[model samples]
Target: MAKAFASAGDMTEKTISFTEVGEGLYAFTAEGDPNSGVIIGDDSVMIVEAQATPRLANKVIDCVRSVTDKPISHVVLTHYHAVRVLGASAFGADQIIMSDKARSMVAERGQEDWDSEFDRFPRLFEGHESIPGLTWPTTTFSGRMSVFLGQRRVDLMQLGRAHTAGDIVIHVPDQNVMFTGDIVEYHSACYCGDGHFGDWGKTLDAIKAYDLDAIAPGRGDALIGREMVNAAIENTRDFVASTYAPAAKVAARGGTLKEAWDAVRAACDPKFADYAIYEHCLPFNVARAFDEAQGIDTPRIWTAERDKAMWAALQG
Candidate 1:
């Protein structure tokens, strides 16, 4: 391999910050690592996304302990990604909720995604052995589901597809705050390996229509205010558009995947080189964009073996 996959060399632990984005709503962000949202309801608590492993989940639990002693009664997974769902078992929440499409994705390619992600970024899976098996949602719904943690109403919605086919967002009506899983990221590269590029902007428009007060994005810092939230949403929009345009152009010209890679790098690197996971997500993003431009709707499953093959092909 010309160089190790980006995550292979990123063994340095990140400093975790627990920032309160809204009243009793918090965002547990670790530098550029995946973020988890905490919604402290009237009686119990609702966790937005589970970390990659039980050990990482425990860290989020500790952050929850600092703020409220409310037991976690619900865990809402925004999508079926391993980093977001595998740690669900550790939460022991009575209700493990996911969108119906998300649960189906879990059945379709859950194990493969777990294997692929683990191999790509082992650092995220600190206690891999502790993961009993693939995480399954106890409850699944389509379109929208309103989950109440006592009197507090947390509306779970499926605006459209962006990060993944099953992507969803957790919205709190009282505070007008939404916990957008990987659908929205701040200062971090959007992982589009399983994404729908054509629908990503539509999804962003859905979230933007809300004009919420705060949003705890999937990664990067918590979006604290209107200006910051809008900026992050648009930034993510720019990232996705910037990544696909050049790759699409290459595909239009019947260029090789390597050529698409070069085009994407030339287009995205100058603007997003300093963003978190920019290099790591580049190849996958480019590959998917190239395929989408050629009319491939569904993203192909990424197994551990395929990850290696893709990385090897993009070594240029």
Candidate 2:
């Protein structure tokens, strides 16, 4: 990801940077906004994640223009989050690739997620009006899919589920680099609202098995060097563990959601106090964790009204 910047609103608080993660592979990361990755192959460019809207997507396009003149032919979405996939039409890519699970998620909950996420984070969806509708992937895969940019092979693998049911990671074996979609967040708040906490840890372990030298995370800067990668992984795991462990403990004690939220806050608030969106994500994270601890496999769909109701019940 070649580095660049664009001033969003003050709520965003920073410009986006297009950092070069590997040769022809870039990560467009905002301060804490949805991160997009770029893979410029031999003949064309493949954007990993589209922004919430075209206005935001164009910023990434502008950065890509600085590096190569190749047209973007594909938009690969790791999951079906509105903040990450809704801007696909703006790229005008001929093909949009996604995992089968991701496609199913869109079919089942895409509309609700679109409405839910828009209400959750308005800044990321700058040009909501420009969106045609729910982003549907033209090319879908089940377990793993390999894309070749001329001779460069980019392996898109559905590692275990963490952030969402359909999470995928783009791996460039030749470059020894991997682009993890929200699987590994650096410094920013972890959105465990719809995550599988137990499976998420396993996914991290699966990612660690790879001898990756560099990684482009879903949020924050591109991580370079082996030690920093280890630290990021550890930090992410710790954050998830702290979140789920406390919530599970409270639930096991027959505590109510309110009590569970408070217990999690007492355990995690001090440790993750400085993380971005701590206040915003805590209530939701606890809710999901509580459900997971109680043997729920799938996350409940989050609607805008449900969001406010949950916040009012838990935080108020």
Candidate 3:
């Protein structure tokens, strides 16, 4: 029998957890569902990643309300993924910030991504109608930008491209807390549909250079201690390398995409088989890795049509 398309069969709801990892830093995770980070500054709050839609985002807003009354003034898009940035309207943040490369990605394929992701994970888009169309960034920066909530300092830096062409990390220097949007996932499978495997490995190294006390990753539970944080980083690095190395080897031998995909699955399934979204992400991840190995640097836009075609060809 053919496998389910993307996460279409994943209909069960997950219990959400709001854990305070640091003094005012919180991670909103849902049993391996897409996670969001909250950084409470002295005078305002900054939301790291918006949920899928306004209705879903409201749940996050409620979580924020329970903790602090300070208004949310900033919403940062780690990259241009629909599941991450489409819910910006709910925050009422004055500044919707993103890396300049991310802004261009929104302009380039945001609509396609919205349609593609919605179909891929229908359960996650429970409030699809509530989305106010593509969420555009009101402000953008190139390398790094810093925002201060009174005396508290939060740094937003683009530390090379990994998950996407414009991935950025939110750093709280004083707290030693880093919100790595999908750049590093803990226990959860890394979705590499739009990933640059080569650059992604180097990006992980850049993140390790930080003196981190805690990390709220894009998915999975927050890492509280240095040991846990380092372990998560190493796990993510191994996942990326393990997946790409075999696929690259196949491509070097002039093998087909299906061959590369099969080889990668056989190698990775044993280790990451139990991880969340591992099966759902494998086909797309393999396709992107195969392309990169074949010398395709930039990722192709994945439209709803292309998503179906790819799934049918690979899983059918």
Name the top TM-score candidate.
1
Taking all chains together, each candidate's TM-score versus the true structure is 0.99, 0.95, 0.98
Index of the highest-lDDT prediction: 1
RMSD of 3: 1.1
- Tens digits of per-residue lDDT for model 2 on 1-316? 3111111222544578989988888989888777999999999999999989998899999999999999999899989989899889989999999999999999999999898887777677766899999999999998898998888898999989999989999998889899998999888778888899999999999999996898999888889888888889889999999999988998898889998898888888788877766677788899999999999999999987787788777755
Candidate 2 or 1, higher TM-score: 1
Q: lDDT for every model?
A: 0.93, 0.87, 0.92
State residue 162's C-alpha deviation in candidate 1, in Å: 0.6
Q: Tell me which residue pairs clash in candidate 1.
A: none
Q: CA shift at 53, candidate 2, in angstroms?
A: 0.6
Per-residue lDDT tens digits of candidate 1, residues 248-272? 9999999999999999899898999
The count of residue-pair clashes in candidate 3 stands at: 0
Q: Model 1: runs farther than 4 Å from truth?
A: none
RMSD of candidate 1 to the true fold? 0.8
User: Residue 258 error for model 2, in Å?
Assistant: 1.2
lDDT ranking from best candidate downward:
1, 3, 2
